[model samples]
Target: MIRKLEGRTWKFGDNINTDLMIPSFALAEPEEKQPKYCFSANRPGWVDLVKPGDILVAGNNFGTGSSRPGAKVLKSLGIICLLAESINGLFLRNCVNYGLPALPCPGVFSSFNEGDIASVQLEEGKVVNLNSGRVLATTALPNMLLEILAAGGIVPLLEGKGLLDKAR
Candidate 1:
Protein backbone atom coordinates (compact mmCIF):
# COMPACT_ATOMS: atom_id res chain seq x y z
CA MET A 1 0.00 0.00 0.00
CA ILE A 2 3.06 2.27 -0.23
CA ARG A 3 2.97 2.90 3.47
CA LYS A 4 6.37 4.54 3.58
CA LEU A 5 7.93 6.57 0.78
CA GLU A 6 11.34 8.11 1.32
CA GLY A 7 13.41 10.05 -1.16
CA ARG A 8 15.07 13.34 -2.01
CA THR A 9 12.63 16.07 -2.87
CA TRP A 10 12.65 17.77 -6.27
CA LYS A 11 10.87 21.06 -5.78
CA PHE A 12 8.99 22.93 -8.49
CA GLY A 13 6.79 26.01 -8.40
CA ASP A 14 3.15 26.80 -9.11
CA ASN A 15 1.13 26.09 -12.21
CA ILE A 16 3.49 23.67 -13.88
CA ASN A 17 1.30 22.47 -16.71
CA THR A 18 1.14 19.25 -18.69
CA ASP A 19 3.19 20.68 -21.53
CA LEU A 20 6.02 21.27 -19.12
CA MET A 21 5.62 17.77 -17.75
CA ILE A 22 6.03 16.22 -21.17
CA PRO A 23 5.86 18.44 -24.22
CA SER A 24 3.36 17.50 -26.90
CA PHE A 25 6.06 16.86 -29.48
CA ALA A 26 7.39 14.02 -27.38
CA LEU A 27 3.98 12.46 -26.68
CA ALA A 28 4.15 9.98 -29.52
CA GLU A 29 7.53 8.62 -28.56
CA PRO A 30 7.88 5.30 -26.73
CA GLU A 31 8.37 5.08 -22.96
CA GLU A 32 12.11 4.53 -23.31
CA LYS A 33 12.44 7.92 -25.04
CA GLN A 34 9.61 9.83 -23.36
CA PRO A 35 11.42 10.42 -20.07
CA LYS A 36 14.36 12.19 -21.71
CA TYR A 37 12.03 15.02 -22.78
CA CYS A 38 10.21 15.32 -19.45
CA PHE A 39 10.55 18.83 -18.07
CA SER A 40 12.97 19.49 -20.93
CA ALA A 41 11.22 22.67 -21.97
CA ASN A 42 10.99 24.01 -18.42
CA ARG A 43 13.88 22.55 -16.50
CA PRO A 44 16.47 21.32 -18.91
CA GLY A 45 18.27 18.11 -17.87
CA TRP A 46 15.79 17.41 -15.06
CA VAL A 47 15.15 13.86 -16.20
CA ASP A 48 18.80 12.91 -16.02
CA LEU A 49 19.13 14.56 -12.62
CA VAL A 50 16.40 12.54 -10.92
CA LYS A 51 17.18 9.23 -9.23
CA PRO A 52 14.87 6.34 -8.54
CA GLY A 53 12.63 6.77 -5.48
CA ASP A 54 12.86 10.56 -5.67
CA ILE A 55 9.81 12.54 -4.56
CA LEU A 56 8.46 15.55 -6.46
CA VAL A 57 7.42 18.47 -4.28
CA ALA A 58 5.58 21.33 -5.90
CA GLY A 59 3.67 24.52 -5.17
CA ASN A 60 -0.02 25.18 -5.74
CA ASN A 61 -1.77 23.94 -8.83
CA PHE A 62 0.92 21.50 -9.77
CA GLY A 63 -0.14 19.66 -12.89
CA THR A 64 -2.59 22.40 -13.79
CA GLY A 65 -3.33 21.89 -17.45
CA SER A 66 -4.97 19.55 -19.89
CA SER A 67 -5.29 16.01 -18.61
CA ARG A 68 -2.74 14.06 -20.57
CA PRO A 69 -0.43 11.06 -20.38
CA GLY A 70 2.28 12.83 -18.40
CA ALA A 71 1.75 10.64 -15.35
CA LYS A 72 2.89 7.61 -17.33
CA VAL A 73 6.08 9.42 -18.16
CA LEU A 74 6.61 10.22 -14.51
CA LYS A 75 6.05 6.59 -13.49
CA SER A 76 8.46 5.36 -16.11
CA LEU A 77 11.05 7.76 -14.73
CA GLY A 78 10.78 6.11 -11.27
CA ILE A 79 9.19 8.91 -9.23
CA ILE A 80 7.70 7.13 -6.25
CA CYS A 81 5.24 9.83 -5.23
CA LEU A 82 4.45 13.54 -5.24
CA LEU A 83 3.79 15.92 -2.35
CA ALA A 84 2.38 19.31 -3.18
CA GLU A 85 0.69 22.32 -1.67
CA SER A 86 -2.17 21.69 -4.05
CA ILE A 87 -2.77 19.88 -7.29
CA ASN A 88 -5.25 19.98 -10.13
CA GLY A 89 -7.97 17.38 -9.71
CA LEU A 90 -7.56 15.86 -13.12
CA PHE A 91 -3.85 15.53 -12.76
CA LEU A 92 -4.16 14.00 -9.33
CA ARG A 93 -6.61 11.47 -10.66
CA ASN A 94 -4.33 10.76 -13.59
CA CYS A 95 -1.38 10.20 -11.34
CA VAL A 96 -3.38 7.80 -9.17
CA ASN A 97 -4.61 6.01 -12.25
CA TYR A 98 -1.01 5.52 -13.31
CA GLY A 99 -0.05 4.24 -9.86
CA LEU A 100 1.84 7.40 -8.88
CA PRO A 101 0.38 8.81 -5.70
CA ALA A 102 -0.10 12.58 -5.37
CA LEU A 103 -1.25 14.12 -2.11
CA PRO A 104 -2.00 17.67 -1.06
CA CYS A 105 -0.48 19.06 2.06
CA PRO A 106 -0.72 22.65 3.22
CA GLY A 107 2.64 24.32 3.88
CA VAL A 108 4.51 21.52 2.18
CA PHE A 109 6.12 23.99 -0.17
CA SER A 110 7.28 26.22 2.66
CA SER A 111 8.64 23.36 4.74
CA PHE A 112 11.17 21.58 2.56
CA ASN A 113 13.89 22.75 0.25
CA GLU A 114 14.90 21.18 -2.99
CA GLY A 115 17.02 18.05 -2.54
CA ASP A 116 16.03 17.57 1.09
CA ILE A 117 15.21 13.97 1.77
CA ALA A 118 11.53 13.49 2.66
CA SER A 119 9.64 10.50 3.93
CA VAL A 120 5.90 10.09 3.55
CA GLN A 121 3.85 7.67 5.63
CA LEU A 122 0.56 7.09 3.89
CA GLU A 123 -1.13 5.41 6.81
CA GLU A 124 -0.31 8.25 9.16
CA GLY A 125 -0.90 10.97 6.62
CA LYS A 126 2.41 12.45 7.63
CA VAL A 127 5.33 13.84 5.68
CA VAL A 128 8.61 14.26 7.46
CA ASN A 129 11.59 16.29 6.40
CA LEU A 130 14.38 13.86 7.10
CA ASN A 131 16.89 16.71 6.79
CA SER A 132 15.23 19.37 8.97
CA GLY A 133 13.00 17.45 11.37
CA ARG A 134 9.82 19.16 10.19
CA VAL A 135 6.66 17.22 9.66
CA LEU A 136 3.32 17.93 7.94
CA ALA A 137 0.05 16.10 7.72
CA THR A 138 -1.98 15.34 4.63
CA THR A 139 -5.15 13.52 3.72
CA ALA A 140 -4.97 9.80 4.32
CA LEU A 141 -5.32 7.70 1.25
CA PRO A 142 -8.55 5.72 1.06
CA ASN A 143 -8.20 1.97 1.37
CA MET A 144 -9.50 1.36 -2.16
CA LEU A 145 -7.02 3.78 -3.65
CA LEU A 146 -4.28 2.15 -1.64
CA GLU A 147 -5.29 -1.19 -3.06
CA ILE A 148 -5.10 0.15 -6.60
CA LEU A 149 -1.73 1.73 -5.94
CA ALA A 150 -0.47 -1.45 -4.33
CA ALA A 151 -1.34 -3.30 -7.48
CA GLY A 152 0.68 -0.75 -9.43
CA GLY A 153 -2.35 0.98 -11.00
CA ILE A 154 -5.99 0.44 -11.99
CA VAL A 155 -5.29 -1.84 -14.95
CA PRO A 156 -3.34 -4.21 -12.82
CA LEU A 157 -6.01 -4.15 -10.16
CA LEU A 158 -8.59 -5.02 -12.75
CA GLU A 159 -6.39 -7.71 -14.14
CA GLY A 160 -6.06 -9.20 -10.71
CA LYS A 161 -9.83 -9.35 -10.47
CA GLY A 162 -10.11 -10.96 -13.88
CA LEU A 163 -12.07 -7.90 -14.95
CA LEU A 164 -9.70 -6.87 -17.69
CA ASP A 165 -9.96 -10.19 -19.40
CA LYS A 166 -13.73 -10.33 -19.23
CA ALA A 167 -15.91 -8.24 -21.51
CA ARG A 168 -17.83 -5.75 -19.50
Candidate 2:
Protein backbone atom coordinates (compact mmCIF):
# COMPACT_ATOMS: atom_id res chain seq x y z
CA MET A 1 0.00 0.00 0.00
CA ILE A 2 3.05 2.23 0.27
CA ARG A 3 3.86 4.58 -2.56
CA LYS A 4 5.63 7.89 -3.03
CA LEU A 5 5.45 9.99 0.15
CA GLU A 6 6.27 13.46 -1.11
CA GLY A 7 8.13 15.61 1.42
CA ARG A 8 11.58 16.42 2.80
CA THR A 9 13.71 13.45 3.83
CA TRP A 10 15.52 13.37 7.15
CA LYS A 11 18.64 11.18 7.01
CA PHE A 12 20.26 9.35 9.89
CA GLY A 13 23.16 6.91 10.00
CA ASP A 14 22.28 3.85 12.13
CA ASN A 15 21.15 2.49 15.51
CA ILE A 16 18.29 4.95 15.76
CA ASN A 17 16.61 3.49 18.83
CA THR A 18 13.20 4.34 20.30
CA ASP A 19 14.94 6.72 22.63
CA LEU A 20 15.72 8.80 19.59
CA MET A 21 12.24 8.29 18.25
CA ILE A 22 10.37 9.32 21.41
CA PRO A 23 12.10 9.49 24.73
CA SER A 24 10.91 7.15 27.49
CA PHE A 25 10.32 10.00 29.92
CA ALA A 26 7.75 11.54 27.62
CA LEU A 27 5.69 8.38 27.55
CA ALA A 28 3.82 9.68 30.60
CA GLU A 29 2.23 12.38 28.49
CA PRO A 30 -0.86 11.82 26.35
CA GLU A 31 -0.13 10.34 22.93
CA GLU A 32 -1.33 13.34 20.88
CA LYS A 33 1.07 15.71 22.58
CA GLN A 34 4.06 13.40 22.29
CA PRO A 35 5.08 14.43 18.77
CA LYS A 36 5.71 18.02 19.79
CA TYR A 37 8.32 16.69 22.22
CA CYS A 38 9.60 13.84 20.06
CA PHE A 39 13.34 13.17 20.11
CA SER A 40 13.77 16.42 21.98
CA ALA A 41 16.07 14.71 24.44
CA ASN A 42 18.60 13.84 21.76
CA ARG A 43 18.02 15.88 18.58
CA PRO A 44 16.05 18.73 20.18
CA GLY A 45 14.58 20.61 17.18
CA TRP A 46 14.23 18.07 14.37
CA VAL A 47 10.79 16.69 15.32
CA ASP A 48 9.16 20.12 15.49
CA LEU A 49 10.48 20.89 12.00
CA VAL A 50 9.05 17.69 10.53
CA LYS A 51 6.16 18.22 8.13
CA PRO A 52 3.42 15.78 7.25
CA GLY A 53 4.31 13.13 4.63
CA ASP A 54 8.03 13.63 5.25
CA ILE A 55 9.93 10.35 5.14
CA LEU A 56 12.64 9.16 7.50
CA VAL A 57 15.50 7.08 6.10
CA ALA A 58 18.08 5.48 8.35
CA GLY A 59 20.99 3.10 7.80
CA ASN A 60 20.07 0.40 10.34
CA ASN A 61 18.34 -0.66 13.55
CA PHE A 62 15.67 2.02 13.67
CA GLY A 63 13.44 1.96 16.76
CA THR A 64 15.08 -0.57 19.02
CA GLY A 65 13.82 -0.05 22.56
CA SER A 66 11.17 -0.93 25.10
CA SER A 67 7.97 -1.59 23.18
CA ARG A 68 6.01 1.55 23.81
CA PRO A 69 2.62 1.26 22.12
CA GLY A 70 2.24 4.73 20.68
CA ALA A 71 2.46 5.65 17.00
CA LYS A 72 0.66 8.86 17.84
CA VAL A 73 4.00 10.63 18.11
CA LEU A 74 5.22 9.27 14.80
CA LYS A 75 1.85 9.94 13.26
CA SER A 76 1.72 13.50 14.58
CA LEU A 77 5.32 14.08 13.54
CA GLY A 78 3.74 13.78 10.08
CA ILE A 79 6.01 10.94 9.01
CA ILE A 80 4.16 9.20 6.19
CA CYS A 81 6.50 6.20 6.29
CA LEU A 82 9.84 5.05 7.60
CA LEU A 83 12.46 3.29 5.45
CA ALA A 84 15.34 1.72 7.29
CA GLU A 85 18.17 -0.69 6.59
CA SER A 86 16.79 -2.74 9.48
CA ILE A 87 14.35 -2.44 12.37
CA ASN A 88 13.66 -4.08 15.69
CA GLY A 89 11.09 -6.81 15.34
CA LEU A 90 9.24 -5.70 18.44
CA PHE A 91 9.14 -2.10 17.27
CA LEU A 92 7.93 -3.25 13.86
CA ARG A 93 5.02 -5.11 15.43
CA ASN A 94 4.13 -2.47 17.97
CA CYS A 95 4.39 0.39 15.49
CA VAL A 96 2.08 -1.09 12.87
CA ASN A 97 -0.43 -1.99 15.58
CA TYR A 98 -0.67 1.75 16.11
CA GLY A 99 -1.01 2.44 12.35
CA LEU A 100 2.63 3.12 11.56
CA PRO A 101 4.26 1.46 8.58
CA ALA A 102 7.84 0.69 9.56
CA LEU A 103 9.41 -0.68 6.40
CA PRO A 104 12.79 -2.08 5.61
CA CYS A 105 14.51 -1.13 2.37
CA PRO A 106 18.25 -1.20 2.68
CA GLY A 107 20.65 0.60 0.30
CA VAL A 108 18.31 3.56 -0.04
CA PHE A 109 20.43 5.35 2.50
CA SER A 110 23.48 4.98 0.29
CA SER A 111 21.66 5.94 -2.88
CA PHE A 112 19.66 8.92 -1.64
CA ASN A 113 20.87 12.21 -0.34
CA GLU A 114 18.80 14.17 2.15
CA GLY A 115 15.74 15.64 0.36
CA ASP A 116 15.82 13.10 -2.51
CA ILE A 117 12.34 12.00 -3.48
CA ALA A 118 11.58 8.31 -2.98
CA SER A 119 8.74 5.82 -3.23
CA VAL A 120 8.11 2.68 -1.19
CA GLN A 121 5.94 -0.22 -2.32
CA LEU A 122 5.09 -2.55 0.57
CA GLU A 123 3.94 -5.33 -1.74
CA GLU A 124 7.16 -5.27 -3.78
CA GLY A 125 9.46 -4.58 -0.85
CA LYS A 126 11.32 -2.17 -3.14
CA VAL A 127 12.01 1.49 -2.65
CA VAL A 128 12.17 3.30 -5.95
CA ASN A 129 14.82 5.89 -6.46
CA LEU A 130 12.67 8.82 -7.54
CA ASN A 131 15.78 10.82 -8.32
CA SER A 132 17.31 8.12 -10.50
CA GLY A 133 14.08 6.16 -10.96
CA ARG A 134 15.77 2.88 -10.07
CA VAL A 135 14.85 0.17 -7.58
CA LEU A 136 16.60 0.15 -4.25
CA ALA A 137 16.60 -3.07 -2.20
CA THR A 138 14.04 -5.72 -1.41
CA THR A 139 12.99 -6.43 2.19
CA ALA A 140 10.22 -8.03 4.20
CA LEU A 141 7.33 -6.87 6.31
CA PRO A 142 5.75 -9.56 8.47
CA ASN A 143 2.58 -11.13 7.09
CA MET A 144 0.37 -10.65 10.17
CA LEU A 145 1.27 -6.98 10.51
CA LEU A 146 0.54 -6.38 6.84
CA GLU A 147 -2.98 -7.64 7.43
CA ILE A 148 -3.40 -5.22 10.34
CA LEU A 149 -2.08 -2.37 8.22
CA ALA A 150 -4.49 -3.21 5.46
CA ALA A 151 -7.27 -2.88 8.00
CA GLY A 152 -6.00 0.56 8.98
CA GLY A 153 -4.91 -0.32 12.53
CA ILE A 154 -6.13 -3.27 14.55
CA VAL A 155 -8.74 -1.83 16.91
CA PRO A 156 -10.64 0.28 14.38
CA LEU A 157 -11.10 -2.63 12.04
CA LEU A 158 -12.06 -4.90 14.90
CA GLU A 159 -14.66 -2.44 16.07
CA GLY A 160 -16.01 -2.05 12.54
CA LYS A 161 -16.42 -5.81 12.27
CA GLY A 162 -18.14 -6.01 15.66
CA LEU A 163 -15.24 -8.01 17.04
CA LEU A 164 -14.58 -5.71 19.99
CA ASP A 165 -17.76 -6.47 21.91
CA LYS A 166 -15.78 -7.07 25.10
CA ALA A 167 -15.71 -3.34 25.85
CA ARG A 168 -19.48 -3.22 25.82
lDDT of 1 by residue, 1-168 (tens): 576899999999998898887788877887578778889988998898898899999999989888777788888888998888898988988888889977888899989989999999876779999999998988877887777777888898878888775665
What is every candidate's alpha-carbon RMSD to the true fold? 2.0, 2.3
* Candidate 2 local lDDT, 1-168, one digit each (tens): 544445567887887777666677777777676677677766788876778888888888777776765355677677877788887787777668777777877677887788887777776676776787777768657777777877777888687788887757
* Pairs of colliding residues, candidate 1: none
For each candidate, the alpha-carbon lDDT, in order, equals 0.86, 0.73
| TM values, all candidates | 0.93, 0.86
The alpha-carbon deviation from the true structure for residue 142 of candidate 1, after best TM-score superposition, in angstroms, is 2.6
